[model samples]
Target: MASPVTRRESRHFSFISLPIEIRDLIYANVWAPKLQLHVFFKNGRLVTAACLGAQTGDESTGTRVPSGEEMTLADNRPRGWASRDLVILRLHSTWGNHYRCEEDWNPMPGHISTERNACISLLLVNKTIYAESIRFLSQHLEITITDTDTALYLNDDAKPVIHDSPPPMIPRQLLRSIRSLNVTLFGSVDLFIALALARDYNATTPLEVVNQEFQQKVRATMDSNQERAVGLLPKARQWHQIWPGIAALPHLVRVNLWMNHSSFDSWSNINERAILEPLQRATWSPEVELVVYLPNIASDNIVPGEQFNNNDEDGLNFRVVRRVRCPDRVAEDSRVLFIVHDMSAREQEEMGDQGLSWDLGEMSIEMDRI
Candidate 1:
């Protein structure tokens, strides 16, 4: 019964003209393994980059960076595609010279192609395609909370001043869309030192003033236990501020909290229980899962590739040392998982030199579940 003109138009149908189910399959192929959404403040404006790798290289093209209007649209989309898979969060760029405390601290390096490709171009094909593709992307979007400073500022209620200015906070709508989050947990002393350095440093003040303040604090930490305890107070307060924001995430499925190895000694001093108290105390939905990666600070000798049971508290070769239940949860509910990786002193030094956090890939092979 079809007319000749209708038949001709059907014959010339484009990709978008296909059933949405077929188009979604094609989109999944293009976006398989998912893309990391790198959200950070650049020149005081909140910017995001979608890349295929752990970090977004300076050489990435503009297509990888979605426009502000596009981000707004993505945020306002209906919330049907909430992800249930494990989402790993990793930083997109390195923290540049924090010791300097300069206003323009993280300057982009000269472009050098990393060959990291992204399928974001598909979003620009057409409005209908954009809606479908973005929704698909949101289902598996992994967001990186670059540092503790940013994490503390995540809650809209939090208004802490850092580096003589209010630190950039993640947008609430964007936070809701995130399925995975990667956060770095700094050592108490290191975190406290950074906060002190940033808060005290002013462009108007002489450079010596900042240096003297830093040196004095370092000496106090070394000389008096009281000073060290005082310094650690901020770390606790910051974590308290951080937990509510994380618990408020409606669509979050997995969170990877990486404890910096350089601060292993300091963290060990504080005790893992105290450090993670805020997170453990916060009520989490049964669908949400948390993994804390810490350096094995136990005196026991742990050999790599050795599998130990979760209940084996006496074993030295255990990969997962503890699995504490979240408060107000049933006996059979999901618990917070803590993974400890044994790193030699030299290896710790190497990792610190490379970056603030170690990659989960390096620990995935040895990981065992309860």
Candidate 2:
């Protein structure tokens, strides 16, 4: 009888007495979703999911893990929750956004999956846990924006309205809390262009640097192929609209831009110079790094069964070489370049962009290649 009473009393001991690092590790294990959490506004309510397909699936058929069983196995098999945590999407005043709770979410409709439940059970357990967990989870997870429209707009009168002028999908309250954000420029470039333009409008862009000599060179390049010339103008105009938005994140430290192949395949030295030159000239606060993942280049000339990353002093670099080969002499080499954070608006003025490299292809450095 005493043993049972002892166990019950131990559960009520202070959790705050543990070291902060241990407490933080516990918070991460309990709250951070294993995969990217997709946040968007649906029917005037904020909805988040770990799996992208979960966004459209019927909630009635979704899996629900009870509070105590979140880490347990089901049907003689592990539910893969060993590393993943549910992304609860309920609106709360904790962030100070003061989003109005919808009737569908207030009572947490029966059909709503446990993954969508506002797991404030931990928050309810004690105020100390709530304060420590919120700050840790907010910074640690990598949030991906799938659809910009849903992220940046609020549903009003059955129509979506930009949350604020020049529109940002993330709430101002949560902006300072996030450290990493990823946005893919897969279909449309409007949102990205807006971001880039907002970053540095006054700097001289390549599109705007057409002098008499430059025009002559452009015309000569186009003389060999008139069709290429015709397409350049519209495309340049589009990119000019994007780079600013990339540079304008108010409180971001890192951003990843995944660009489609066709969009950048035609970029010549001149075009690449234009897009990058302005960045070197512009200034950023607390410095924000941008990693541009260009589509892989198709070339059979690449060495097979080889993959490696480079220790470029300028910035972080990676090169992924594959094994198989196509019938034709064409294969894709996925490479990426990094733009390091500019320390300040003034520091960048003297040092330029710090990590501007033109080596887009595999470098011929004579060293051990992975």
Number of the top TM-score candidate: 1
Residue-by-residue lDDT tens digits, candidate 2, 315-349: 33212222111100111112221212212335334
How do the residues 1-370 of candidate 1 rate in per-residue lDDT, one tens digit apiece? Answer: 8556677777797887788889878977887644555565676545554433321122112121222211112233422221111111011113211111111232223323232224656666788877776566667667765555556555656443457554433334445566788764433345434433334333355546645565566566563354554455445345555776776677777886655422223223333443455566676766777776554343333322232224443432112332211110001012111222333466457546644443444223332320
lDDT computed for candidate 1: 0.45
TM-score of 1: 0.48
lDDT values for all models: 0.45, 0.37
TM-score of each: 0.48, 0.39
Estimate candidate 2's alpha-carbon lDDT, on a 0 to 1 scale.
0.37
Q: Backbone clashes per model, in order?
A: 1, 17
Which 10-residue span in candidate 1 carries the lowest summed lDDT? 324-333
